[model samples]
Target: MNKKKIIANIVKVISWIFVLVFFYWAIKNNMLSHIYEEPDKFLRLLKQHVTIVFVSGLAAIFTAIPLGILLTRPKFRKGEWLFVNIANLGQTIPSLAILALAMGFLGIGIKAAIIALYVFSVLPILQNTIAGLDSVDKQTIDAARGMGFTPVQILWKIEMPQASFFIFAGIRTALVINIGTAALAYLIGGGGLGVWVFTGIQLFDNSFLLSGAIPITILAIAIDYLCRGLEYLVVPKGLRLARKTNG
Candidate 1:
């Protein structure tokens, strides 16, 4: 195998090892027992929280896409730095603080958590999208113009197709972050996997924590791999060739 293949394999092995070790620690600590004892409650929490994740994920995507487009536009040159700084600031804010602030108005449950997670998740997707759009070559833009493509046509037919990989990469990151943060929703009674972890921590029930943590970690990994597959499908052939050549 080539050096790059070896490196990829090593990374995969390390990831698997990390996951397995964490799972073992949680299980040995009996983190999942509470949820196991009452299957019905566990199911209810899962149902309640899944909706929160979906809502939060959608909110982040909606906010990010438009902001990303606006930030990447040439006309908005002066505003770009300000927007990037604000997005970066969003990443720095503590999730707990965001949740606390939202709870006063939203009154707890998944709604508050959804708002917090959605807001926090936007930065990655937005930044990636802007960068991706900016990365498209100026020569390509000129060629598209020469070919009689309108601004919309150029964006949809040329730029967006090339930038798709970056956008999807951002989404993949957001999805994983969403899954992990969904657990924190339990703090406000949003009742997802975090309910198990939090309850287990409070009651010293290793089983409870393990049940929640294990499933979430697994789900995140599964979704990440699935998104990578989707990214491969969507990425343009030229980009793929370029990547291969660069490697």
Candidate 2:
């Protein structure tokens, strides 16, 4: 393997090790005692927060993919630039401000926080998905057309397959960022790891902070590795060969 791949692999290994160590340390330090103290409340809190995360993640994808598809297409697909700009502006909006704004209607909780993370996560996935689809070989697209493929077929069968790696890369980036941002949600009374972190700070409990921080970091690393595997799986063999040759 090349030097870049070797280094990437080493970093991945170290990341997982760090996660394991941090999680163990948090457990040993009794950072998780609060959950055990009130199992029902703890379970409810975790479930609610996880639901928010999943919903936010999906929201990001929904807002992202349509814009991505439009922007990546060769011709203007009706308000393409407008859609792209709107998504771009979503990213530009500060998360704190968004959360506060959401609080006006949604109240302070997972709903508001999910809106914040969803907004933050949308741009990268959208931009990368568009870029990835656009990056596909033009000749390959032409060949598909010559084979009598419709626009829809070209998109699903040809474009998406080629774009999978970049799309997944965007997802990987979004996941890592969301894991960290999930902590911020605690300020608005959203659950998840952020609850511990924020509560720890307020109560002068380092263990609570560590408990939150460690799990988040581990989740981020795990998602990153999983994305890498998907990237490997979806990246076209021809592209890999070309990369190898160029390297």
Candidate 3:
């Protein structure tokens, strides 16, 4: 294996070990006592949290990917900057402020929080989609053109296949970011694990704090690994081999 692969495996091993140790410690110290006492509440919040993440993430993916494709077209290229800046606004503006604004327009609830998250996620995915499309080796496309491939065919069979990795990277990053930020959903009564986290802050209780915090951390890590695996599986093996060799 290459040095990068070795180092990555080592990191993964260490991460899993840390996760195991952390969970054991939490259980041993009774930090999870409250979670056990209210299993139903825990499950409900988990479902809400996962639902919020999944819905927002899916929306961002659909919106950004198509918009990115539209922006990359030759006719639309000049206007791409406008959309990029618009998307950047989502990132530049504070998430809490976005949520507040959403509350005014959409009202406070899961919908508001989901909109805030969708906005936050759009930038990275959109930027990456543009980037991934741009990264398709021009020479490769030129050769396809030489062979009589239509623009549409070249995009689906050439550009997209090659750009998959970078696009997935953006998705993975956004999802992980979403998982962490979802904790704030509680502030607006969106109902997620954040409830306990902020409540613990109000009451100054470690157990309550950990009950939410630990799960968020674990959820982020788990989602990241899942995305990473999906990236590997979805990207062509030839690309993986080429990347491995290049790395």
Ranking by TM-score: 3, 1, 2
lDDT of 3 by residue, 1-247 (tens): 8778999999989998988998999899999777889999999998999988999999999999999998999999998999999999989999899889888999879999999999999999999999999999999999999999999999999999898998999999899999988999998889999999998899999899999898888899899989989999989999989987888
Q: Which candidate is the best by lDDT?
A: 3
Where in model 3 is the C-alpha error above 4 Å? 1-15
Which of 2 and 3 is the better model by lDDT?
3
- Winner on TM-score between 1 and 3 is 3
Residue range with the least summed lDDT across 10 consecutive positions in model 2: 41-50
TM-score list, all predictions: 0.89, 0.83, 0.94
Q: Which candidate number would show the highest TM-score if scored against the true structure?
A: 3
Ten consecutive residues with minimal summed lDDT in candidate 1? 26-35
Model 3 RMSD, rounded to 1 decimal: 1.7
lDDT of 2 at 246: 83
The sequence of per-residue lDDT tens digits that candidate 2 reaches over residues 1-247 is: 8898899999989987986786778789888777577667656655665676678888888878777887766686566667778877666877777778877779987888888888888888987888888898899999999999999999999999888877888888887878787777877888777777787899999866665666566667677898888788888887667766886
Model 1 lDDT tens row, 148-238: 9999898888888888888998998988988888888888767788877887799886677678777787778887999889888899888
Error (Å) of candidate 2 at residue 103 is 1.1
For model 2, what is the C-alpha lDDT against the true structure? 0.79
